[model samples]
Target: MNNDTDTARLRKLDQDHHLHPFTNLSRHSQQGGRIISRAEHIYIYDSDGNKMLDGMSGLWCCNLGYSQTLIKDAIYAQLQALPYYNNFFQCANEPAVELARALVEITPAQFSHVFFTNSGSEANDTNIRLVHRYYNLLGKPKKTLIISRKNAYHGSTIAATSLGGMGAMRKQTQGLDYVHHINQPYWFAEGADELPDEYGIRVARELEQKIDELGEDRVAAFIAEPVQGAGGVIVPPQSYWPEIKRICNERDILLIMDEVICGFGRTGNWFGSQSYNLEPDLMTFAKAVTNGYIPLGGVMVGDRVAEVLLSHSGEFAHGMTYSGHPAACAAGIATLSVLRERNIIKSAADDIAPYFQQRLQTLKDHPIVGEVRGIGMLGAVELVRDKHSRERLAPDAAGAVYCRDRANATGLMVRQSGDTMITAPPLICNHSEIDSLVNMLSKTLDQTAEHFNIR
Candidate 1:
């Protein structure tokens, strides 16, 4: 299946049978999608043998890059030893137990327990159950509502999608009535007159206001990503997290940090909560846990919630069949080991991150670039028609879509969220790879500007 004929056959098969997520079915069925046949290090190759830098790290998960023999070998070994097992009915696997312990060790001291799931969606779904169960155990069944920020991306399952604040996601169906949303700390898009710091503070205060309006007793938890990954890497101002912490503390609301994107060293630290100095009561994590080798996600249960849940005598009655699959857990253990032994997270934070961010920042001066913002291995460049006024290039975000396609054609993999072009390169990317990614993106931006007739 290496030649053009085979590639066409595969594309035809996919178009006829596969239903992709977040895709325009009509457009895809007509044009077909590029077939990614192989990946190595920070690059992926199409069926036609075109190599491209993976600027977004395979949807922001392949932090260790594509060819990690350690993780592959671990998965293989686990398959040989204990290929399958169930963590249900008071049973557990060695890999699962060890992986959980490793997670607890690397995360904040408060997180001593873990509840595994197959993906971040399931982890967040577990969060809802756990939060509700905790409140019910404490005889506060009325404390059911969860507060989330608009444009945040938690996951795609029913409950997870409801917990998230994307309006487009909620438009198709009614969300859980218990969940509510507040404005995001997207200063570039939303901060019109106020300073970024002021805007962040104001938006952060919205959580407190919502809690107050809902009568504190009714609000069980407040969830958000440390950095809004799918929401265009909107890094809130320095004043944001502290104020959020204060609000949650003073209001007695559980803080749920969705680290699905920022966990496992994407943000320099093992977790984004650590990067932002946030001490959440519950943290939802996935993606890089196993470096995208296998499906694995879990909640890093903080002592506050863990103690309450543990002290209760009744069973939680919430779990998945693949909650602690042995193979995935083994991959997770191997991934974590590699990250620690190689000091990959630290090196990325101290070395690659600076270079990556510096190169990303250089795009701010481009004629169509309104803003360039990022931290660690994640970043975004906002495209605008009028930089000073922040006028969007297209009302329906078509500009970003066009620019993203251009980037892909130019040999780079990046994501477009609304009008913002985002990238989260693998943590293993070297200076040369980072430069390649940025150069491709720069070319894409220039092409987009010319295409739109921007002077």
Candidate 2:
């Protein structure tokens, strides 16, 4: 994949047959895409040997970066020992059991058990099943309605897609009727006229309003990410989560925190729930669980839900073939071991993340940068034509799209989500690597400003 001949052959095949997710199929077929051949540390190399800092951490995974030999060796060893196995019909793999226990130990005190799945999408889908069953057992079968927020991205499965509040995705599928949405806590994009704290409280109360509108008895759970990751790192104001916590507690709605992007120290704390100081009945996790080395995701079943689940069980009647595949579990165990031994999460929070946020914060003064918002290593920069009024650089997010292209061409890998440029660099990045990423992004911003005539 590194050489021209192989790259060209691969590109043709990919364009001809590969239908990529979240892409314009016809455009991809016509223009093709970059062939990422290899990676090291926080950088990725294309087929042409163009090295770009992985500012998005390989789609917000790869928290420990590409050089975790521990994870690789674990996967290899697991393959040699177990090769493959299914956790079905009274069968349980050693690695799977060990990983489950390890997860319980690290997560919040409420999380005492886990249900494994191959990806976050599946795990979120499982949330629906578990929530429904929990209520069914409690004899409240009507309490199946779930409330989410607009632009919240749960995952891609039909159930997860409906659970997510992204309109573009929901329109493509016949989503579940049980899931409903309220507005997101994106103050800059939606509530600029109001003070941030005021907007936060107002938006937080929308959850209460939504529950009331739908009848509190019918609404079983309210699901949300601690920070809106795929929705452009929309960091809620300081007042948001506390108010949200109040609503869930008072309304008797089970809180489901989608920590797929914010878990395992992406949010400076071990999990977003801890960072926000909220307790969830269930938590969705994946990606960094294995440091993106293998496919493994699961729900951290908090005691609130687990107790009911355990009290009554007659073959839960829901599971995947690869629910607890041993190799993936080995990868997860090794990843957890690396985090514990090195204390990567805490160190990143105290040092790397602060520096990363500081460097990106400098871009707030740029001519076209409307705002810079982030916590831990994840961040977003909104591109604007008029920073005062918060007018976008171009209609339909063309400016950020152009800026993203410039960044990739100039050796930095960042993402464009609507009018905002978003990044979640690996937690393993040192000061120098963080500097490289920010410097590349800074240059990209200058080019974007010049191109857009934003002076």
Candidate 3:
């Protein structure tokens, strides 16, 4: 089709047929939409030919970045060989096996088995079901509740959402009764004056207290993101993860780390579990598994958990049609190959990420910057009206939107969650690209401060 025809058709089809996820449809209809024609390296080209830097790395995935030929070739080759397969009924594909093996090689040593799904949500949903069922099969049916930290983003599926602590996500839905929440180990908002270890331990104690209140028998597992991603990149205090690990071990409750955002080298380590030193029994992973090229996610179960699962009868009783899709699996293989062969993790975490953070820290001097937090390639600049008091910028004063617009106008594609501008550039970013990213963001910060009339 011609460009004009394609654009018109897409606009019409989108307006009529497409219901975008996590969006207000009615409002979107009025505004039409931004059409991204293509992406190259760290830059996305809109239909209007404007280039924008992808600061959020396309929802915190895209580690290998856009238009990598290796991933394309893998999918093509897989289609030529075996395009699809069913993992059901004792059948599995080569790519699935290879992908699972690849994950095992890189993931924490504790995770020995991998279960596939189509997305992070499904993976987490599977985690909830599998963990709960494992306990039930062990004759502890009363152990059901999955304790999650407040402001954590697990996933959007009912069970996964139930584990998440975002107030907005929990608002309208009738949350699952089996899930419970505890205070996040966010020292910034919760205990600004306290030492990191002290605040972390204090917040970690809440888990024990909640277990007592809910009755230990009722709690089967505790789930969390190593770093709170969607809830504004809230990194925990130093003492938190260690204490959490100890508590879970002492109580015999399985620990589930939702690594959907922080997995696959977004953090300095291969997984957020490693970054935080979390020894989890079950974990959900996606987003970066295939660099978002194809939808693929899975739960990595520890040997103990897997052993318990295998002992039970009747197939574990859950799966999606797209589970272990050959093409997606092929893409995953290629993505991992690129990650390991190129040593992207070390490059991002040890070299590039440190540079990213060093440049990002410059913004902390700005009056609007309350706190700058992140690890490796992922980072966030939090805007505030009063830094000392931790006063948030008024919502929709166009604070975040204004900054995003200014960045895009200057050929940068930064995303904002609340008042924080999040950045997770592709792992392939070079030093020059890194400098450009920081310069563009710095300029946008200046513009935002000027727009708000802040000193």
Candidate 4:
């Protein structure tokens, strides 16, 4: 990292060969980004020797931060012991079996079984197959349409992308025809003139309307994140989930909660569905399940769905080669151990998360900060020129891009989602670390305000 020659060589190599996910390829090749050298605790160092506080928690994973040696050691031990094995042909590894049991224990009472995959995208893809197979077993083959919310992120595979309602992602992926979308509970941007609770109810009923329009008999399931994470950390109103739960109960439809970002203590509970008090028929989880140390994801299939799937005597006819990779499962087991034994979820919920929210709330008075909304450890600050009217500072979300760049230059790793500055800091962050993050963000706000003439 310290060597200029090696740094230049590495940069060139990356610019030439690496095809980064969710990045502008032409821009990256022309102007390469920082090459991260190493990390410890909540900080990452680049080859240029700049140290950055990882405000996004390694893309909303690494909840325990970079120094969780227990997870690393578990992966090493598992690899040394079993090396490689596929959960196929009546085969299963010890870690995979143990991890499945642990997931059932931590998740809600309904989730008695799990179906593993390599990432959340694949897990959601699995959900489609599981739903179809379950309904087909029940003699309801007409149930094929799935309902999601606008601007919500599920994943990026063709089916997952179809499940996701992001127009940008769907534009390129050619989403499935059976998938449908409804309104998101993004009060600040979409809740014009109405109170949040009112908006929540109105939007929640959209599910019922869609089901009726598409014919209730054809509707298969409803999938959504507890909070819209990648579409911007847009938390639903207090009334949203209750209404959603009611609709699902009254109608013959399934519910799938995409907890890829809100799982593993991010939302003050083992899972975000617990925080919101909703029992999803299926729950998709990844990211923090392995503490981002390794790729591991799955669906926590509820008893309602599991019973049908188990009762039928036939191959599911769907599975990944590394459906339950031993090493990844080992990492997940260790991650869950850290969460349960230390009570990290409740601890952070009681102290650090509240302090983090309070610190972020201080930015509300800034010239460019229009709104500050957060829950547990995730938050977003929407930027605007005139707070009352909610006028954007620039077109095409250029203002948020500028603010994120300023944040990075000031040694704080963060991101711009739409027109908001989004953050999902590590749950292990203390009061002092929260202050440092806020101070850096405050400074970035000042720079951004001046840059855009936003007095």
Candidate 5:
């Protein structure tokens, strides 16, 4: 059979056998699927040869865009030299060590050590273990709970899921406890009446209250994304991060920044912590690290935390077989090189990102829009049933479906997170593409309004 026929058959089989994440299984079975054949720049070509602009940048991971020859060559060379090597005991690879050293240069000045993992989820999971082990080593075995903001997303793994704040993800694990939830610093939803600084301080105070309620000795860390990604692209006010940093420092609680979606130039900086002025004691990184070309993630720990963990146990208790896999490390090195050589991050923020953000803001004038919010390459348009009332558009037939489908029809690929439609074009996107992305979004929003019978 031809390749197209084979792809079609495989898709059919997948419909019958596979269970998709963050999707309605029944709806997926009825709708079938489109097989993406290839990708170049910011566009994905399906098996049917239709090109769609990837406004969400393949789940906000492909920051460098698709088809980077540098990364491809690195993976190929590594595969030829050494396909696999486990980082156990004294055994390790050069690429892993080199990548870690390179990371230390770009990350915040406090991050001194790096631990490798296969994905962002695994990295966050590793963080939990390390945090608990660090406390245990310090003879503070009572510290076990990690505080995370409501609507934050760290990852899908059980421990990572426990640390996440998304309601739907949490519901999947009934009776799962240990992680404490705090109020998100979403000024749009939570700070409707209060001043921005007042709203920010109110949410920041929640962390202190939570620590007091749980007892300072019982709380190990406070983990959050500098800008909540999967939780609807929520960006906190300037007052929030400084207060959070102050609280964590005062409480002696480790501040862990999950930069999975906001890292590596996506937020106009090397890391989100830099953008938001968050001085995290530990950070979980993934997605853009390898530019989604390879499955690789890692955790960077500050000297203090590292010292505690090392003193407690001579050996770390957890690891993945593919941790520091040579091939993935090679891809990461190459991707970082391209990011620097091309100055993609600088160009995106200095030129295209500002233009894109401005265009996105224009949508706020549209009657159907509740709010338009974002930073750098990441943006979200919140659709409300009543813009003045700020009532959330229902998630079922009342929300996401109309906007997402309409955008797809216009050849733009956007993602729906509850009532918010998130857009994160690749950092490599040019001004023309940014214009196209914004224009297409306007069309999609207009069409979505008509579909909802809204004026």
Candidate 6:
């Protein structure tokens, strides 16, 4: 940890100038927040020198952990060779071109092209334009409506926010009229009374209902996260994805998988689409593409969309100044190299993931835990007042907020989305680290139960 950091001074400075995202600004300014000064592997040290296991993987991005020197060295090497370059005016940089090729190689066979962006929000914004442009080129200009799931989080940018289905985000700004939303396959909250498979099918059918209501021709595409990450790691039932895929295929509605959080082995696969056998026409990727060491994101354009965009005569007229940044692309290359060379992703899937899921499952017997659902490295524990009846605690998500604070106080970082406590640990965690994480979480849950006077 950095011993020289003046924790109080830094906190004061942050409160004065730094406005955080998705935060209660006034409360944050008054209380301040943990100033993370350093990180190594899966542990982050705050300004006060307190180390905490980062169970949320640094906002669900740093899959390779925090100590990978390869990505850092790669960025330095790129900076030394060429500090900056633009991918406009028929110009291209080596790192950008190479990273694009690497992305295509690792992603599903259908994806043959990539359009880079600086972050997931920009990537999803690009998706909206690309989807509309593709249909316009094919002479179907009216196919502009996009269908998303309720509680789904895409990004915070205006266009990306419009594409998402989060009520709070939508309430902050007027959303685009073309974007629509349907019921999410959140079985624990929305389908507790029915068998999971049956509930999955029923919720999956909502997409069909939406398409029919909008008229199939009027709908441009349906976008969704393979596993709803920000929506509390809501892993849909086994019957969900297949039925959704069938509906998309039968209705001729394009499927856009928002792989921003689930991409790069979070779901124990290179991409979440592969995990659920989803063949989307486009996939939004960010976060782990560079292990969150640098900002880099893009849309993996499948053959169907690529061919149409490529065949069009004129320019697409949408891009960012930092799109395909040389240094960011270099970080991406090095991150992918480490993931492949060390077999980190495969190990996470075949070995670490099973152990992680097993440990998480043990929390199901907790009195406050109504359900424990997870897949691969991501998991969530639903907090309820009555487990048998699935009755949510009063004051909405107060219980989850309490549990999250307790976990943080116990040196474990987790997230609370509504009444669900979610986690996505770094893929590099070993058996011992998994045990520690689970133990810390169990202790936090126990304390929360005691606070609520529950067994």
Winner by lDDT = 4
Q: How far in Å is the alpha carbon of 18 misplaced in model 4? A: 0.7
lDDT string, candidate 1, 53-95, tens digits: 8988898899989999999999999999999989999999999
Once model 3 is optimally superposed onto the true structure by TM-score, how far is the C-alpha of residue 166 displaced, in angstroms?
1.3
- Model 5 off-target regions past 4 Å? 1-7, 393-397
Which parts of model 1 are misplaced by more than 4 Å?
A: none
Tens-digit lDDT track of model 2 for 200-256: 999999999999999988999999999999999999999999999999999878999
* Position 451, candidate 3: lDDT: 82
lDDT of 6: 0.93
lDDT agreement with native, every candidate = 0.92, 0.93, 0.86, 0.94, 0.87, 0.93
Listed in order, each prediction's TM-score against the native is 0.99, 0.99, 0.96, 0.99, 0.96, 0.99
TM-score of 2: 0.99
lDDT of 6 by residue, 1-455 (tens): 44555888899999999999999999999999989989999999998889999999999999989999999999999999998989988899999999999999999999999999999999999999999999999999999999998999999999899988889999999989999999999988889889999999999999999999999999999999999999999999999999999999898778999999999999999999999998999999999999999999999999999999888799889888889999999999999999999998898999999999999999999999999989989999999989878887658699999999999999999999999999999999999999999999999999999998898
Kindly provide the TM-score of model 6 when superposed on the true structure, using C-alpha atoms.
Answer: 0.99
Task: Please identify which of the two predictions, 3 or 4, would achieve the higher TM-score against the true structure.
Answer: 4
Predictions: Cα RMSD each: 0.9, 0.8, 1.8, 0.7, 1.7, 1.1
**Which 10 consecutive residues of model 3 have the lowest summed lDDT?**
1-10
Q: Which run of 10 residues does model 6 get worst, by summed lDDT?
A: 1-10
